[model samples]
Target: MTAAPNTTKPSGQDSPSTDTAVLRALRRIRVPQTQRNRELFLLIFAFLVNGSAIALVQLGTMGAIDAAFLFYCGALIVLVLAMHIVLRLFARDADPFVLPIATILTGLGIAMIYRIDIAVELGGWDAYSTKQLAWAAIAIVGAIAIVILLRNYRVLFRYTYIFGLAGIVLLILPIIPGLGTDANADVWVSLGFFSFQPGELAKISLAIFFAGYLVRTRESLTAVGTRFLGMTWPRARELGPLLVIWLISLGIIVLQRDLGTGLLIFGMFVAMLYVATGKTSWVIIGVVLAAAGAFLASRVLPYVGGRFSNWLDAFNPEVIDRAGGSYQLVQGIFGLAQGGLVGTGLGQGRPYITPLSQSDYILASLGEELGLIGVFAILCLYMVFTSRGIRIGLAGQDDFGKLLATGLSFTIALQVFIMVGGVTRIIPLTGLTTPFLAAGGSSLVANWLIVALLLRISDAVRSRPRVVIG
Candidate 1:
């Protein structure tokens, strides 16, 4: 009847419609592929920058390049390329910036470690730089394994309680008699030739557990809070979980004598808790509790008391002369001052003058050589990395992913602030490594795993189709 009436739709119009649909599909497919190409370019740039740093260190320290150093660099490049291939296969839509940023930071750290090793005359496998490179290789492999195995980030939510229990066990491992080894802090566990910091692993597991737990209980937490002083506060009954976490943190501080890890774990929980509940009063309560804990810790814990004293009276001759005094803090400040605006040109600066220059004081070491501009550049890398993580969190499709990403990003931001502040004399020193730029196997492994998880989440977020309802 329609043909008879000559009322059929035009074929010309239908051709245009089909072309438009095909174009839209092609665009959708090309976006992720283009993003992957950009990632590859950035990764190549990162590799070149890292390689140059290694070469510079060789030339500056020994006046020539070493074949062994080149071999190490080649191995690193191969491993990193392998990681990039893994990402291409499994995490095609993931953020392009994360891996490159991590690579740059890790490379800078290795270069600095090697410089320090040269200054100290350490050689072969005994060199800290060699060990750092080895750890880098291991960490990269671990990250590759994670991206391949943990294809779905949401699966972690299924075993929330199990993750929590595992975190507790990890935290307690260092306290066990034969397993635990005392280092600068009592957070290390030794197994034959291998020593690791279980607290590092514990923090990650705890992040997953906290994300899952908060997602489940967020409604209850946000529902019945009281308003006070322009803020909503949870009731005393509601504060039970927080109190338990605080006590656990305090136990870590007192028993393990690790104020940094304790503070990190507790602060991460508080940040995530505030984010989940959208309550400022939780922050206030956290601050008040933190202050009270600090006060008591200063009065009762000798180490805490000493740190406070150092922060307050760093320039005092008596404090400076005391054992475990403000000498390291003061030295770090001098190094920063010496660095001025343009740094001492990498190998020319005396970063080795600072205590634990390769680990806790790496930021100060970098400041001494890179100068203020260089230091700020390094900080910018961290800032970008953290901001990218936050962006991923904000873009997530699920509440659990949002909390997890935010918490992980906050954890890194807080750690950097604390470490930098301590080195700059803005706060009392605590023993936390500077993420990718520090020389520790546990920290390296944990941070790489973080990178892998974030990649997984970003891939999932980007690949999901957006719905536009009329």
Candidate 2:
């Protein structure tokens, strides 16, 4: 009772102690400010590079700057600035390099699209470049909304099953009779004036689902069941999830007729699974499954078989001359060859001579115009972006965040590899877009969403208190 009576301090003395405690708490919780400044500076440079590319395209093509270019540039700047503001408000401690890298890639894509539009004499709203700019704006808005709404990446873990269900629904949407649109691949869903690839959104939803699912089941998955060639493998029963995913991927390839997306989705799952379990055996199993899937698809599916044929005999006279043959592949190769050491200068190249110059074969068009050096620079940008995302994943404090980041980052890397490798004849072309550098609205939206998620994760990781092991 005496000790309790002496515990109460004077109000005057208590006020100072309370204030000191408050200051200390504030110091601990205060967001890091320097990273944002570096991001801002890089963003400015990205904008300059983007603007210059547009200007150069205008000057190189039309010989003068036009009102359309100016308007698009102004709108792009405003949209990006708004995104930057939103980031500052919600993700103050996010990675500094991701946003700028995405911006530069998007801008470069638009510039290239615009250049192609001019070459094709496509003006007004009919221009692919105009559509690209609009999509870019929409993508920025989507990113902003994601940052504001999903302040914590961990909240996604609460609805893991819901995300998985949503992803399945999205994947099947493109195959629905009335809703589906038949393009080169049966992957698009049309709603009157708008057509979209649901697979893009499906990828994001699936990544979340996979991250959460693996986190909850990591112990069982990682428990060693068998040993072979100095590696411990999971039990056959433990691989039910992988088998299900692989079958779904095969279905995508066979039914939807999109080998690229099938490969992309399957590859992402394998990458995430390996990271979660830290098992090379899972990778071996995945590769074996992938090889089997590819072999089966090549034999049974005409589209998949055609891709293999194109890859193997692209320059063959009969193969190149046949309808829906290797003509596109050969043209892409020639375009790259034309580029050589240095590109033919943006507007000077005949990139439009190749089909889908602004979409599927856009990289070839870019290679033809930017040369090997420019392609190298663009590849370097992708390398940095992917590396930063992996770094964020590695630094994550939670298993879900790490897997999600890794899956998303690996998705980008895989898509880039598929596109580049296909175009270079290192693999069969899969018709996947080159991430932020492509002319597809669906791709741009999906990629920007990824950037937003990575930003949120990075902010959480940086803001969280670190544990120092003594």
How well does each candidate superpose onto the true structure, as a TM-score?
0.96, 0.92
TM-score of 2: 0.92
| Backbone clashes in model 2 | 1
- The sequence of per-residue lDDT tens digits that candidate 2 reaches over residues 15-103 is 67777866766655554556777888998999899888888888888898876687767888888888888877778789999999999
lDDT of each: 0.90, 0.90
Candidate 1 C-alpha lDDT tens digits along 1-470: 44556767776556667778777877877777788889889989998988888888888778898878878778988988898888888888899999999999999999999899999899898988889999999999999999999989999999999999999999999889999885756899999998999999999999999999999988877877677787777877889888999999999999998888889999999999998988888888888988898889999999899999999999999999999999889998999999999988768888898889999999998888889998899999999999999899999989999999999999999999989988898878998889999999999999999999899999998995532323
Which residue pairs clash in candidate 1? 343-371
Evaluated at residue 350, the lDDT of candidate 2 is 88
